[model samples]
Target: MKNKRKILDWMLLIAWMILIFTMSNQPANISDSQSEGAIKVLLLIGIDANSIFGQLANFIVRKCAHFLEYMVLALLYINVAKHYFTKKVVIISTVAFVFTYACSDEIHQLFVQGREGAFRDVLIDTCGGVTLLLIRLGISSIKLLKLR
Candidate 1:
């Protein structure tokens, strides 16, 4: 049973890495423009229509998808890490490391011709991680309550 989980964990980790690589290498023009424009429109209608708000909205719109993607990856990785490692420390350390790796990946995009890395995007990405973590935690708590 233990060995099975270990294998699954490694497999999941590998798949996650492949996804990260694919996302990094994906063509940006189509997705990027869609994200930017959608956010702009949402901001224009949702916010006060100020330029700053528009820009902020655009930024969030542009990066939120990536953030959500990372969040899912992180959650899955956490689950896999928990399976392979007995200690809570090991699982948490892996999450932190994975999160840092995500930050670095985004930073790497900055050097790409069409990509610009921003701290705000990292923050948004972290929010995604936290959001998913909270959701999963909530689900776990609910399950525990039911079990009790």
Candidate 2:
């Protein structure tokens, strides 16, 4: 049963990595079309739908994707790492691994037509990982206080 749980965890991690890679492989135009649909929904809610605002909305959606993908990656990494390492080591290693992967992911995008690797995207991804870690720590602290 324990082995089964471990296997499931690794499988989930690999599946998520594959999903991220497949999305990164998409060309900019294909990616933009998905974001444009979300922008249209925002417009329906009465946000500005002018050309400039639409472009800005697309940009936000893209960055948010980066943020959310890494956030989930970090959470999964934490869960896996906790099974193998002490808490302090798990936190440090998870951050390092997630940040490194984010950098590599952006570099992968550089080869895709109409896509250029940007360091800013890596930073955004790192922010997402760090934010999740902070939230986890906060919740743990709250639980400790309640126990006392």
Whole-model Cα lDDT of every candidate shown, in order: 0.69, 0.88
Mark the regions of model 2 whose C-alpha exceeds 4 Å error after superposition. Answer: 41-54
lDDT of 2 at 114: 88
Candidate 1: Cα lDDT at 90? 51
Task: Score candidate 2 by TM-score against the native.
Answer: 0.91
The C-alpha TM-scores of every prediction are: 0.68, 0.91
Per-residue lDDT tens digits for candidate 1, residues 1-148, read 8888778877887788787766665556755676766665767786543355655655556566767777777777776767647546654665586568678877777766677666776777667776777777788789999998
**Alpha carbon deviation, residue 118, candidate 1 (Å):** 1.4
Q: Could you tell me how far off, in angstroms, the CA of residue 105 lies in candidate 1 after the best superposition?
A: 0.9
Worst 10 residues of 1 by lDDT: 47-56
Give the per-residue lDDT of model 2 (tens digit) for 31-87.
Answer: 889788867786788775545554477888789889999999999888788778999
